[model samples]
Target: DFSEGLARVKVGNKWGFIKEEGGVVIPPQFDEVYDFSEGLAVVKIGNKYRYIDKEGGFVFNIEFEWAQSFSGGQARVKFGDKYFEINKEGKIITQGREDLFPVKIGDKYGYIDISFNIRIEPQFDEACDFREDLAAVKIKDKWGYINKEGEIKIKPRFAGCLSFSEGLAAVSEFDKKWGYINKDGKYEIQPKFDMAMDFSGDRAEVKIGLTRYYINRNGEIIKEIIDIEHEEI
Candidate 1:
């Protein structure tokens, strides 16, 4: 089920879309189906995948061996042997051998292009997926941010750090307390929370003492959820 007024259902060997009342809307004709995003969903037929609108109509003629949902109007799709970004209109935004995602080599992590080209040398002990155009990477027990060009955007400093959310990321220092930092690596919210979470809709859920509360990006508590149960991740 998704916010687009449709739910996924499997009937026998195929999958399709249904309504809240279990009424078949698209029928079980697809080999597989992914959740709707924006206004389209990825459906698999035969061996190729294509994007379909709410009425189960193809949005464009473009098809791929594999495809992912659209985000920010761009979707990642795998062609014959390379990955590329396609817009809603089915125009390739970035093609060629650029992987645009991180790759693991031996025991190190680095970025690679679609053709498996080592754009960024494998050197980090640990790395995470890119968020807000920057990725959190660990080198020598310190975490920092890196740009797509493999250059250090923020020097490795924090004991631990998370991917950016709402233009800020949660970081921890030697004290093991969580705070928020901007893209420039400046502390926008000082370390205070015993536990922190990523910001969503301008608000973040945090824990202090034994209670959970929601805080704005300014680090001000907006509301508290009493008697809630949670465990540290």
Candidate 2:
């Protein structure tokens, strides 16, 4: 797929870049390539990954075992077994910071502290990072919220859910409808929308059928769009 005015194409066993007009910009030479982002792209040569400019020139002096496209002027790279974020100049900017990160053991998921100590035992079918002091966990197929201590604050009942944002989490129940629920598992807004997103500031975007709109924390429609072709919200 095309990104930032260029698309990745494979010729023989080598990957390269082509302009929107179907002309070769960067010749097929790398073993693999990722879409352009922030004016640069990640390309793999042998087992090492490196960033390259649009003109196919190397952007950084260092190479990574694995690298991701740049976003917000930073990209994630893996060295040894640890992942770190690097700036455009290939300088490590950030390392691990979460107090507890999710880890999988066998078929169940649990939480481990930054020191690699098991804080929560593996029991839930799925687990996510803590947000606002709670994390979304799944048992079998139902989703719910749990505290840092692994206590099930909200029983697994939702068909799907997003982590808490501004004290409310978007959850779906019967009929696949989505709504906002408070930390106590009480519905702040009734389930009705076909799709829902996490709240940013005071508003969240939602979709019902072909209609899309923004709703306030009170579940009131602040803005609406009708009969628009379905695309990313």
Candidate 3:
């Protein structure tokens, strides 16, 4: 149930939150804001950012170079170009490796535990969020997915990818496009997009030139692209 009536809201000049029915609960005043999680939300004010509570309060008065929303009781926050995990109470309790985050590392990435300990060290060089205890990690440029135990569950072959959603993940292989795959690493849909995005309601977004279109699981174009610069291809 929505305690404040609004699940999301815009506060002032920037987007913040108030709860149900636009109550100005958090005071709309940030460059960007994420939905409330575990009673807290991440907000960016000016160039600096911090987390705020439902009561428009700060949870521990801490800030970081970058941050991920609280997950499994903690969130990954960055400092001085390095990533680490902090508890909900705003305490720095875990530290990530130099290249754990990956996209900026090389071609692989790893995960850390609550104690700032490396659970999965700097590996895949490229990786997406862990889903179903598995994360899509990249190696040498090809993205395969691995489990929390650092075991390669699905071998990397797709060029670009995203984490699993509804037991399927989107993967891309050549300059022409994107497709979907199952948890077992088998193609649910062939790689064939000029551009592609994740699936929502059994429909995924694909692009033709600069226009966007939606396709169903059977690979049928259910929707057409609109307002796109057709020449941008």
Q: Candidate 1 — which residues are off by over 4 angstroms?
A: 1-99, 227-233
- Using lDDT as the measure, what is the rank order of every candidate, best first? 2, 1, 3
Q: What tens digits encode model 2's per-residue C-alpha lDDT throughout 47-126?
A: 98988999999986766678999999888876434566777767666254346667675578888664335789989888
Alpha-carbon runs more than 4 Å astray in model 3: 1-85, 88-108, 228-233
TM-score of 1: 0.56
All candidates: TM-score: 0.56, 0.58, 0.54
- The C-alpha lDDT values of all candidates are 0.83, 0.86, 0.69
| lDDT of model number 3 | 0.69
Which segments of candidate 2 are over 4 A away from where they belong?
Answer: 1-97, 225-233
The top-ranked prediction according to lDDT is 2
- For candidate 3, the per-residue lDDT at 233 reads 50
Lowest-sum lDDT 10-residue window in model 3: 97-106
Cα RMSD for candidates in order: 12.2, 11.7, 13.3
Local lDDT at 144 for model 2: 92
lDDT agreement of model 2 with the native: 0.86
**Candidate 3's TM-score:** 0.54
The digit string of per-residue lDDT tens for model 3 on 159-220 reads 78887876778888756477888889988888777777777778888886777889998767
